[model samples]
Target: MLTDYHVHCEFSDDSVYPMEDVVRDAIGLGLEEICFTDHVDYGIKVDWDSGEEIRWRNGEPFANVDYPRYFAKIADLQEKYGDRIRIRRGLELGVQSHTIDAYNRLTEKYPLDFAILSIHQVHDQEFWNGEFQEGRTQGEYNEEYYREMLRVVQSFKHYSVLGHMDLIVRYDKAGVYPFEKVKDLITEILKVVIADGKGIELNTSSVRYGLSDTQPSRDILRLYRELGGRIITLGSDSHRPDHLGAHIASSMELLKELGYEAFCTFENGRPVFHPL
Candidate 1:
């Protein structure tokens, strides 16, 4: 079955594509399922009731998803289109070390089918805008990012997968850092992920971003396999319509070339495997 696990629509701060339209587009593309992984970055964005004004990026407001409205809309759509396509409720938790308590409360409150743990920002500094990487040497910034990631995985327990395990490369104006430099830390991070029964995402957005390879890179995938890590998930990381399910088939084929036999989907926070 073709499923896009990392999808964001109007519920997200940076996307204006409406949720229902996203479902319709997925169906038209012959996808069997599409999980709505809307964004909620606690440290960078505020909740709807926080009484703070939202910041915007390209006309879209930067704020956490409206929990009550988001879920209610999903429920209505599920009942309306259950026969046509499987719509799973999910969220991308842009987690940081100090924001664990906020995520803990949100996880306990939502009946999420999946949750992607991503380090979109650390210490409220964004990688995209170079705030997190400012004034630091390439090596220092990379290590610090991975260190925060390791800490997050060790302390956080509510996510289904690690979103874009090496996402730092996406915004590294200094160019891609050598993997060997951070190999030790990545190894530890993957070990903890495997031990906790969590998976790592292969984000297809890397392709649109004109990257040299996949978001996690082929080397990372190979390392995970060598570590006896069995679970992997494919996501387009799509915020716009044209990006949905982009390069998914090719990504699955790439997984097979890397010796992966299956990719996964989630239900009630547990993985369900599908052959590659």
Candidate 2:
């Protein structure tokens, strides 16, 4: 009855869990269906020099990921658990606004059941490597981040859902670019995403890390709804087995309170609603 649209496996440069563990965890959590959206970022440019920390090393923006191996593993899991659980194959493609041609190559290679197009890198920089937090006024940094993210949404025509709307704010500890400062921009971003027929995700990763109530928060979600942004997916952005279905109850409650009657789920790449 519950589903998590975002999960990562060893194929991702950051995650280390084998596909079996991911499937096992999903089963344990009673997830009727779950999607393993492995990393599909190309040319993200990380510090490929010196002995980097494990988090940075394992999760450094880019990797020579084995796509064939990834698909094979997913196929194996799908067959292995076909009766007990519904395992959906998916990928989270990192988007760089200017690299549509490369992204086109990726789409050509892998036909995913679902695809999450995210702005993990901006201005040729990686946010996960902590590079996005480097010296700059917090306000300036967040504005720049959101602007780049909006550009990403506008430039790409692919992707089933927009992973996390205000993901850059996860780094804004000082409340610098407060929701108010980014309200208009957030509205515009949602307009573009909705107009393009893409969905937004209520990523619970922010809650797990104690960063914020949700990745985009109440204000943004409300704004999104008010602006006619309907399709919304819920994901933990889980990189490990234990994190599967991390905060569905809480996130669902938040969505209902925000006046949303349903959350979006996908079946064969089509949006379906599960009433909240």
Candidate 3:
């Protein structure tokens, strides 16, 4: 079964596609299931050290989320497409070290099938928010970035899966942060993720970005397997129709090569595996 867990519809601020269209595309791709993990980013604080190069807005980050309407639409899709495909209600909550209370509240209030906890912004500056530009050395930038990600993983423990472990490298056009060089940092992050019993997602979006084969690289995948990190999920992280199942075949092959015999899916907060 092809299960793409991390996807966004118009409900997410950065995506413009409607939920119905997203469901249609998934069915066309021959996927068995797709989960709509729309953005739930909240809380923004400016960092003075980031200086003038940084230009962005700050507020209750996902203040636009209309919970009543959001859940209503999800219910509509569930009834309309119930026989064809499995549509799971999910959310991608942007979390920092201090946002644990808020994160817990949102999770508690919802009947989510899965929750993808992510670290999008760091040290009061959003990674994609234009605060950190492309000129800095990858080592210097990724070190700081990974450190904050580790802090987020350590602080927030309620999530079912860690979304895109190395997503900070999304904008590293230079490809300077080789996985071998940062093996120690990556290992530390993976240890915490596994120790906390959180699953890791193999987000295929990195292929579109022209970066490493997978978000965490082959080395990280191998390490996860070696460390007994059993719960793994696969996703296209698709926002548009055409990209619904992007690079998924290659991602599965990578997992097989890394010694993983199966990939995972969630229902009512319990994981089910599909054998390779």
Ranking by TM-score: 1, 2, 3
Give the clashing pairs for model 2. Answer: none
Worst 10 residues of 2 by lDDT: 46-55
**TM-score, structure 3 vs. true:** 0.88
lDDT per residue, candidate 2, 1-276, as tens digits? Answer: 688889887777778878899888888888888888887665553222324422345335456356678879888989999998888878887877777677777777677778888877777676655677677778777887778778877877768888877777665656636677877777788889889888888898887778746777878888888988888988999988668899977888889889999988776677888898
The per-prediction CA RMSD against the true structure, in angstroms, equals 1.0, 3.8, 5.1
TM-score, candidate 1, is 0.98
Q: Compared with the true structure, what per-residue lDDT tens digits does model 3 show for residues 1-276?
A: 777898888777667789999888888888888888888765662222323232333432234345667789989999999899998888888887777787787778877888888888765567774476455576877887778778888888767788888887786666557777778887888899898878889999887878746776666778888988989988888888877888787788878878899988888876788986
Off by over 4 Å in 1: 56-58
Candidate 1 has an lDDT of 0.93
Deviation in Å, model 1, residue 67 alpha carbon: 0.6
TM-score of each: 0.98, 0.89, 0.88
